[model samples]
Target: MSSPVKQTLKWAQKLLPACDGDLNHAKRQLVWLKEKIISDRPGGAIDDKLSEQEQTQLEKYINQRVFDHKPLQYILGTQPFCDLDIVTRPPILIPRWETEEWTYKVIQLMHQHLDKSRPLRILDICTGSGCIALALAKHLPKDSAQIIGLDISNKAISLANHNLNIHKLSIRNTVEFREKDVFNLDLKEPVDMIVSNPPYITHDEYNSLDPDVKEWEDPRALVADEQGTRIHKRIIQVAKHCRPYNNDLPRLIMEVGGTHQIKPLTEEMQINGLKDIEVWKDLADKDRVIVAH
Candidate 1:
């Protein structure tokens, strides 16, 4: 009842259960194998340099790792975020749906704040993979927006640079990446808005996360101290430092974990003099983002 290719995939699937390994991992490996076979077909005028035996060995090699828990994103060396393909390596957090939503919302808010004739400045903190900054730079009205992305990790900044180059979104004059800790950033000019999806998962929550995530994603990017309010507190504190001298303070938009995280962070923002603080819900109607003036 099964074609030869289908049978080959079945054997690989049986050898590696979807629960035991990532379901997507098995599927990707099969795709790679099929491509190789297709490209090497006889009389297709392609080099059959890899003999049939060698091809079989390559599939087995990929299958063995799929049988393990290696993340498919890491295996593929890339992930999709907000219509962009981003490079992902170890030590950089993979951008998630919530992060993209937060970034998109910031863009929407910025459009409301700045009219077509005025240019707006935006800052993105803890910019792993440069997803937030790059997405904003790519989508915002090119003539009226500037974006800066900052990350503590040098590796992350490097990857961000690569991605910017890849997308040709490098308005080298307008978009920039910097190596700096969120807690210690000092901007020369006041920005119109600051956005971040900082590390907010508590230690207990980190430990309880799905093994697929806990085992593969960067641990440092996921865990935070003091019920996951530590980084959130620091970002709010820095915003207080950057508050404009006159009436306007840069608006803040941050992605928090959920409703459970709303109260403590709201209180912290108020204590730091961040007025008009409010929590925004994600698509699921859970409290997923916080906004303050």
Candidate 2:
């Protein structure tokens, strides 16, 4: 008498014992099985009858994938970021709550600096699924904010565009996605602020990450050289390039890997002559975000 999803969940519990170490894998399997079975319902309706044979086949396929360590977000192709549903895939890093926290801080700072009458232009570097840019566009004053999201990966750009359309936000036009390396970017117009959650995990530490992450998430998006601040250093250097063109210095808000990264990053900021450098801690009291003028 149980629904198909309920039956699938029960089956997952039984078959996932061998994979007991990976609870995320087991949970993903359950969700995938439910979605697959529901999608196959007659007339695309969940109320439509599902034959016993159809349910059995779906459970088999889902169990196999789950045991293999594939991520649930990769299977579902969507993740939630600050109330926005974002499209995701293999090459992009799944949106994390820490990134959302830093993004909100950037928006708050933007409100203080940008004038009420003029439109505020913001740039998000290393944009994975366009979550930061899209979230800002959705929350900021519509009449005075414009956002642009840039990623080096074409796949990431496409996925971000897809999320923008799915949300049905008119900010799509204002929030453009492009495949451009943060190191080589040449900005024509001066942006009010530039924010990024660039790769800050050291290569050594990256190699030691949990299997679920190293196996499923994009490695490039997670790992970096020079103790994980290589990309962050590049972003700081590039911001200087924009200073000559725009009379006003742009503020930078970056999410760091850990408190250890603060020293190296602060030195980089000093070498680049950036002002007002400070570290912002997350709710956990760890220095997670770096803000500078």
Candidate 3:
């Protein structure tokens, strides 16, 4: 007989078409569902066999994924980011791997460069689910950083706060979530670093995206004006108010939409007297993040 993991996946694939379906996505949903069901059970161990009840839960999740067209992350109610499982819901962007990749690296960079004696303040504009901010809080030196996540969506801000609370017992760093528009906000306290994974998809591109994405993820987190550079440019403009970073520390780090956004956004960064700039590639080798001080 196949292992329980295999049987569980086989069952889901039959319902969701995994053999030659949405490829990794279809497979991942099945795998994650199995893992989620197992981990959520009281006294359950990873090596333990799945119970009949677990299989029933998996079937329900499969129906949600296959018939209801809900994204797997949302169905799971969380997405792993760095070392934290960020709670996810509708209208708040689920954490993406690209964001997680850069975020993990950013935490490492902070450890290597930030002054340990002074309290670090980080502002995450368009914070969405607070994944980046929470990840930073979890990984950064204990009591070393104060993180604030800002979003215009009340739902997004509330969800961000919820994620922070979920990990509150373990995370010691100061973190807050506020509903504020980036375009019109006065900084009561200047931040040492500004990071964002703002909306960068154009209207045309957004319309072309899979209906599942449009239905589940928040459009305001994915679509931006000015051909996907509007929010990026605004972040660059806002970088001036942040405390400058030296010794290879980046004061401003923002996710962008590949090469098309690099030139114009970097030019705007330079216009703001930011002389040092670096473009970091995501795992896919796409220019995914721009760093400037």
Candidate 4:
């Protein structure tokens, strides 16, 4: 036990340079890697420790890839969003802290304004990892809200379903995962709300992303044409097709790029006939989510 711990500590020391000399960050990655190796074992026993050979293999694994600045969520295959442990994998955008922050705020607003007696239907477009959808399930009334998480990647849908089941969210039955291109989405009924953290990174910005993201994460899930507002425009255009429920305008909440996205996105929402448009900033006070009816 001490041998493996000592070995990983040495490995962490060697990896510290790649973590910007942050010893804590390097140690956290070591711990995460150990957890991953153990969880892959039968029954996932917590007391199970690695053998000398296994520790050597783990060291090689970290040295080869993860310490080279790969996103830690992809390395560990999970991320915490709200109170749920969401499954994370490649080709699906990992849940961002900013997205989680705004999602909780949206849920709070829904609780205050939405009719609790009636069922609430929510559509989550580009629902990578299903973090936003599952977060809503964990928070909203399990008996009332029906959430659908749509992503173009089948892998993302599968991972989202895995997250939904693993977390044991009581609302899992009502939370559905589907593979659909948001650009061509056509709903049969108008949902109470539509929320998305779609691909909003501009092409130029995508080119300049960190190698950790550029090499490991999915480009299709990140970059958009036309200054990152192309998909945002499509989302707004499709809003005209959805019918409003309960004599109230259907709610639209979407995560945007930055302050640069505010003016054009708001104008696009208004042109698409959405009303009551507003911008919500993230923790950094950067404009992040656009809320409209």
Candidate 5:
């Protein structure tokens, strides 16, 4: 009978091979499983002295699934995104660190340019887990900003609402999660900014996604037509048309696929009359965010 921590560590080491040597991911899965068992206790504290039956049940529940490459975030049912606990479930694309990094950048940029006194409305398209929208609401001035998270999946919208309630118990800000396809959006009120992390994986590329992604995530939320550039192009065109008649167009910021995507996406935005188009790289130095004014 090994201590629970030691037992979990041992299992994590064995899981490392299946995770492509990702020790952190393996350990995170173990921790998530451990937390679930101890969740009812105050502070969600862990006890190393798990009874033999408890240890057996825990191992049986998670070990094989982890070995088969299910994403830890989905298994845990939550992912941390820019200080928000984004609830993740099946078919909703898990929030990535790259998106988190650039989302913060967008927030910082907005603070620098937008008038703090004026109320700001921002639309989040393809807001899978409401990670980006909720993060903005939590960080920005509660009284000055209105955020809407739009998604095509009803399940995602439900989960987003649950996540908002969990993470924003004392909600001082306005954040709405709605089921709306980005392809067919009609905004009654003009927004000051628009942001998204839309699907950009091409059909061919989708076949190459990791088993964890291919098996567990939603294809509609992962694949796009035309070499993964379709949704991005549509968003640019739609944003152009949805611009407020009396004011300058809403500032657009989006997460793109890669360095190759930056040129083509920026070009599409330029064709749609968007100005001040800029490409930003993630921490890995890979082109990740495209900003257009």
Candidate 6:
């Protein structure tokens, strides 16, 4: 008889023709569902058996996946980011590996360079689920950083607060979530750093993305005008207007689209008087993040 893993994966893929239809993604979801719902162990010779009830539940989930084209993360209702179990919700962008990787890097840089003798204030704009802010609060030197997470959606704020409360016991600093529009945002106090994983996907690009993303994720959290540089410019303007923090702190650390975004964003930062622009590429060697102070 075929291994249970193989059998289930085959069944899952057959049901996904109406969905993303990517075998690899289906396999991943299959394994994750098995591990989570059935308590099956990963790796090695797979021998876990599913009970009738379990099989029924899995079928229901697979049906949802195929018929609704819903993302697995949405079905499971959580995403792991920066070692934190971030809550995922519909219409709100889920945390991606890219965001997690860069957030960890930013935390490390902040730990090494930020002047922790005094309080440090950081803003995470368009912060869906508050993953960045929560992760920073969890890993960064606690009790000294006041991280604020801002989003334009009320549901986003509610979900972000829910995620924060889930980990509030371990996080010792102040992390607040608010629903505010970035375009009309006005801040009085200067901040040490501003980090964002804004919507930079172009309309055309968004159209071509996987159904799991195009169908489920909020377009406002993924698409921007001006060829994906609209929100980036507004963020740059925010960084430009903020007075420089005292001595050796990054003013802006923002995730951007691949290589095409770097030059123009760097120029925008220069024109706005922000210096020390640095491009941080992802493991694929494509420019993924831009930093300036």
Candidate 1 local Cα displacement, residue 256, angstroms: 0.9
Which wins on TM-score, candidate 3 or candidate 6?
Answer: 6
**TM-scores vs. true structure, each candidate:** 0.81, 0.83, 0.88, 0.88, 0.89, 0.89
Runs of candidate 4 exceeding 4 Å displacement? 1-9, 38-50, 66-69, 243-250
- Tens digits of per-residue lDDT for model 5, 110-204: 56655655667788899988889888888775566788999999988998888888877645479999999877787777776789999998888
Candidate number achieving the greatest lDDT relative to the actual structure: 6
Ordered by lDDT, highest first, the candidates read 6, 3, 4, 5, 2, 1
Tens-digit lDDT string for candidate 1 (31-133) = 6555555555665645534466755755654664445545556655677887788888876888888778766777676556556545566778888899888
Candidate 5 pairs with clashing backbones: none
lDDT of 6 by residue, 31-112 (tens): 6776666543334435557767777778877787787788888888899998889999999998999888899998888777
Residue 10, candidate 2: Cα error in Å is: 3.8
After superposing candidate 1 on the true structure, give the runs of residues whose Cα lies further than 4 Å from its correct spot: 1-3, 11-67, 169-173, 241-250
Q: Which digits, one per residue and each the tens of the lDDT, describe model 3 over residues 1-293?
A: 78866785677565555223755566766677778887897876776566778777778887776666777778788888898888889867888999999999999999898786687889999999999988999888899999999999999988988888789987879999999998888887978889999999989899888756888887888999999999888877788888764566788999998898889988899889875789999999999999987
What lDDT does model 4 reach?
Answer: 0.80
Per-residue error at 32 for model 1, in Å? 7.7
Q: Which candidate would rank higher by TM-score, 3 or 5?
A: 5
Give one digit per residue, the lDDT tens place, for model 4 in 167-217. Answer: 764553378899999877887866777889989999889878888788878
Instruction: Count clashing residue pairs per candidate.
Output: 0, 0, 0, 0, 0, 0
Residue-level lDDT of model 2, residues 59-92, one tens digit each, is: 5666545565665566666777877878878868
lDDT of candidates 1 onward, in order: 0.74, 0.76, 0.84, 0.80, 0.79, 0.85
Residue 292 of model 1: what lDDT?
Answer: 86
lDDT of 5: 0.79
The total number of steric clashes, by the backbone 3 Å criterion, in model 4 comes to: 0
